[model samples]
Target: MPLSREKIAATAIRLADAHGLDGLSLRKIAKELGVGPMRLYDYVTNRSELLDLMVDVVYARIADVGQHSEWRSTVLTIAQATREAALEHEWFADLLGGRPHLGPHALAVGEANAAALSEAPAVRGIDDLQRALGALNAFIIGAVRREVTERRTARSAGTDEAAFQASLGPYLTGMLKTGRYPTIARLVIDGAHLNAEETFNHNLALVLDGITSRPRT
Candidate 1:
């Protein structure tokens, strides 16, 4: 088959899924595609371009939340969809927020998010919209990274989240006993350990609330 950008990006994504970004290279993708590495350069200019293409391939999977009557709902839908995509492509979290995504699919996703927030009643102007999107992006990226890290940790530990937590229970308990961190001790004693989805939704709502509640200037 003739080499194409799509083919190159797809092979790169598959390699990344298995070996992660560090394992991904033009040579590896070329090997996977049964072509010389130099041939890939014909399609992708360089490693950076390859990464951009890989990121866009993943972004293409995210469904548009579309414009909705309630801006919050639209924002929430977009956030959820993004999280889902990142979870599916664990490498996505590493690339996300690292640089601007100018690909068509990435721009479509951004456009949807911007449109939703722009129509928000509390959004005073461009500044408000920028801040709101910035906040959402920060939360989404952080949350996804945390979740992905935990997943990798759990897998590496050869245990589930509960087992891993249990393994840490002794050390954590001992640290909490220090009394130097009173609030943290209290949280250890009383805080609910929400699952990843619950934690994401709960925190996302809080973020959205903060954005809407900000005073219009």
Candidate 2:
């Protein structure tokens, strides 16, 4: 019997999550598995190959849509999956921007999104689908980046976002009381209902507003 690719990928993911991608190496993975460095190459040829496999391993978790029956739902689900991918490996976003067109995970995600968006009623041509996919990917990637960075920052500072924001909420409330920034105050006071889901929805709808608004033949 041979070492399973799943076992090798898991070791790499665990190592990347713990030490960041910068420190991830074949030797490190082998050390984690209690095997020689040469043993890893039997499953994956090199670090590049290992990265591709690792990416697909993460992407394999995404839900395969039968169709884009609900565009909003698909986008939101993918967005949430993006966040999950980033959180699963702290170094994911760090590796994301640079490893395009090469990693298995990277291409798998693109294929998934392209297939989903291509089925949308609003998509008219290949060009339309391509542009929409580009915009959607950009919007989602930005959302995940913002979330993971903020969460990492908050955690490193010994607090989570809610507690940190709560400390400032009172100050914001006082500013509202004195009317220093009346419009902002009003929004803040009323925006207390704004949670993560709501915020993401607001941004998602805003982006898709253009898509939904496009002249349909």
List the global CA lDDT of all models. 0.87, 0.73
lDDT per residue, candidate 2, 1-217, as tens digits?
A: 3577899998888888887778899998888888888987778888988887877677666544222557656666776766666767666766555566444555665766677676666788998888887787677667767777877878777898877767677777777788669788767667674576568768877777766566776
lDDT of 1 by residue, 1-217 (tens): 5999998998888888898999989998898989888998888899999999988877777745465787788889888988998888899999988889999988888888898888877788898889888998999999999999998899899999778988999898888888889998888788888788988999999998888788755
Candidate 1 has an lDDT of 0.87
Clashing pairs in 2: none
Model 1 scores worst on lDDT over the 10 consecutive residues at 58-67
Which regions of candidate 2 deviate over 4 angstroms? 63-72, 101-108, 166-193
Candidate 1's clash total is 0
Model 2 global lDDT (CA atoms, 0 to 1): 0.73
